[model samples]
Target: MSKSAVSPMMQQYLGIKAQHTDKLVFYRMGDFYELFLDDAVEAAKLLDITLTTRGQMDGVPIKMAGVPFHAAEQYLARLVKLGKSVAICEQVGEVGAGKGPVERKVVRIVTPGTLTDSALLEDKETNRIVAVSPDKNTSVWRGHRCKAANSKPS
Candidate 1:
C-alpha cells in the first residue's frame, strides 16, 4: 500500500513527526506514550524497552513502542540525559463529528541542552545554556533565568 493508503492515525503521527525530525515524538495515546517509526526503533534500543507492532499499515507492520504516561518523566529524563530531544504531543480536543481523529498537538519539547522543570534541574541557578557576547552587558540566558514566556520584559 502507498502512503495515501495508510491509516488516519499514522497520517496524523507523520504530520506531527515531520515538525520535529530531530526529536523523538512521544505521541500520547491514552495511558501510554507511543513511539512510531524510527523513534520506536531507536528508543526501544536506547531505553531497553520492548519494541512491538501495534498494527499494520501499507502491508507493513507499523513499528511501535511505548511507556506508561505516568512514568514518562523518568523516560524523558533518561532520553534527555542521552542527548536526545523529545516532543510531547497530547490530545488537544474531542474527535468531533464524522470520522475525524482526536486532535493532538506538540505541547513541549525537552532537550539535553535545556531544562526548565525544577524536577529535572539540580543547581537551578548555575546550570544553563546562554548566548554570551564579548560585551559584559549583553547576555542572553535561557533555562529558569529567562523571563516569563507570556510577559513582556519591562
Candidate 2:
C-alpha cells in the first residue's frame, strides 16, 4: 500500500501495533474488535470467520475481519489455546472528540501464561506465568488477576 493511501484510523492502528509485534492486536471499533491486514487473514483462517474488505488503500482493498465484543471471550480462549497472544486496543473517547481519528490504545496483552478468567479456563486446569532463574534451577510464577483492559485507567 502506498503511504499516501492509508487512512488516519489505519495509521493510528499501525502506531499501536508497532509496540507489540508478536501478539495479535484486537482493535476495538464499535461493538466489535476488528483486525486488519495479516492479523485479519490469520484470525479469519483460524476461527473460520468470513474475511472481507473494509476500504481500499492505494487502490487495493484493505482486508478486514472481526468478532463481536460479546463473543470475544470464546475467541480469546481459542487463540490463547493456539499459543497466540492478543493485544486489545480500545477506543478511548467519543468519535470526533479529537481533531483526527477516534482515540484508541492498547489496553491489554493476553497470553497463555497469564490467564485468570475462569470462563476462559477449563475445569481442573491451571496457568502459570513464569520467570526462570539465571542458573535455570528455579522458576517464579506470577499468579494474579489481569489488569482491566484499558490503556488508561478510568
Best by TM-score: 2
TM-score per candidate:
0.79, 0.80
lDDT of 2 by residue, 22-136 (tens): 8889999999999988999999999999899988877888889999999998999999999889999999889878587888988788888777666677655545444533444
* Candidate 1: segments with Cα more than 4 A from true spot: 95-98, 122-126, 133-154
Per-residue error (Å), model 2, residue 75 = 0.6
lDDT of each: 0.82, 0.82
Candidate 1 residue pairs in backbone clash: none
Error of 1 at 62 (Å): 0.9
- Across 76-102, the per-residue lDDT of candidate 1 in tens digits comes to 978977889999999887756457678
- In Å, residue 23's CA in model 1 sits off its true spot by 0.5
